[model samples]
Target: MNIVVRDTLEAAEAAHVAVKQAAGLAAEEAALPFKQARLRAEEAMRNNLTQAKVLATRVGRLKQQALEMARESQAAQRQNSTTDAHRMQDSARELMKEAQELESQAKGFQRMAEATRGGLGIYALRAKAAATRAAQRVNPGGDGPLLLPPPPPPLRPAPRGSAK
Candidate 1:
């Protein structure tokens, strides 16, 4: 498990570097859908962080399921049901593979959470500082997801009046 996580993290870091190299070109060619690029990137990072959390949760659940299957396989083996044991073992292997993939996805999201600087570097730093301050507040916890509220929408300008 450590090896798997270490390998995935290494791969994601490499991906992060690659993405950074291309980010300037990507940002330039892409239309500025919104006027507030830093706000958008902050929002994007928060969302990616949320996804990473969700993926990690999924991986954890999958690992538990795989463990359950292993336990059942052991029970089957004890009962002399070789066929059932084989089937359960195979299912456990599949579950482990799924967990590994989801773990890698989580790592990727974690790596990308802060990768959207591009031209928004200065603004992004300020936004991150603000967000760090905001995160200090007690996060609501329980059954519900703990997502950060998105930055407020950019203020629109007042309508122009007719020239005198």
Candidate 2:
């Protein structure tokens, strides 16, 4: 009889442990998507940074080319060329302007990448906070969540015959 009772207790304990293990696994599985999304966002930020670097390099080269072209146009005028020097000057100025615009755009993309990285940091912090809150809800102790208190209720309407 004692052997039978011990076997029953051991079986119950094993089942309980299995259930808890399964619950923990389920929680981890549910959080997997969030973890994947966070990683993707981080990768996207990195890609944006890389693209910005490439754009900056292109802009620099474009500016250098424009400057060289402008110098060549000036040297042509000195060589007593009969072509329209003013037209060449105007073309050089326009190319330089476009290059400057491209540089500005590259800077803008760099700023966007920086902002996205910041946002990812904030997102990670928020996810951790939310997970902590959920754990607190389940356990209610052991480094409780730093949750804020609920807001007060709205004012009720006065009764129809209430004093003014």
Candidate 3:
């Protein structure tokens, strides 16, 4: 009877240990999805940051080109070369367009980063803001003044009456 009781107690202790281990395994299994989701969010945030940096660099280069074009346009104008001035203005406009596109892409990445978890969103936003501030410094007035073409000359009233 003593040996049988000892065997029963040992069995119970074994069962208890198994149960505890199973419970721990169950808890880990349940947390797996959350862990995976967190990792995915972190990865996405990293990707967005990478894209934002690329766009920022592109914008910086475009801004530099625009500044150079503007200077060239000014020099042309000063030299009384209206045609060269117009061509340089067109080139500057193209540079501005490219820069604006890159800025937009960077902003999109910033928004994606903001949608993610783990403070990555904040960093993304800050990067975008810094890029914008830099662009603004290069292009004061948000895009500089519009350089619209002059309107057509008005028709003479006498010519209109004769045509009628």
Among all windows of ten consecutive residues in candidate 2, which has the lowest summed lDDT? 142-151
Off by over 4 Å in 2: 82-84, 126-164
| Better candidate number, 1 or 2, judged by TM-score | 2
Q: Compared with the true structure, what per-residue lDDT tens digits does model 2 show for residues 1-164?
A: 34444455556657655655554455455556667778988888788788788878887887887788778788888888637555677777887888788788878878888887777766566556656555445444334233333323443333434543
Question: Candidate 3: minimum summed lDDT over ten consecutive residues — where?
Answer: 155-164
Clash pairs, candidate 1, are none
Judged by whole-model lDDT over C-alpha atoms, candidate 3 comes out at 0.70
Model 3: lDDT of residue 75: 96
TM-score, candidate number 2? 0.68
Per-structure clash totals for the candidates: 0, 0, 0
lDDT (Cα, 0-100) at 141 in candidate 2 = 36
Model 2, CA-based lDDT: 0.66
Mark the regions of model 3 whose C-alpha exceeds 4 Å error after superposition. Answer: 118-164
Tens digit per residue, CA lDDT, model 1, 103-164: 99999998888575444576745555444333333221222332344323452222334221
lDDT of each: 0.68, 0.66, 0.70
Best by TM-score: 2
Q: Per-residue lDDT for 16-100 in model 3, tens only?
A: 5565555445545554555565667799988998999999999999999999999999999999999999999999999999999
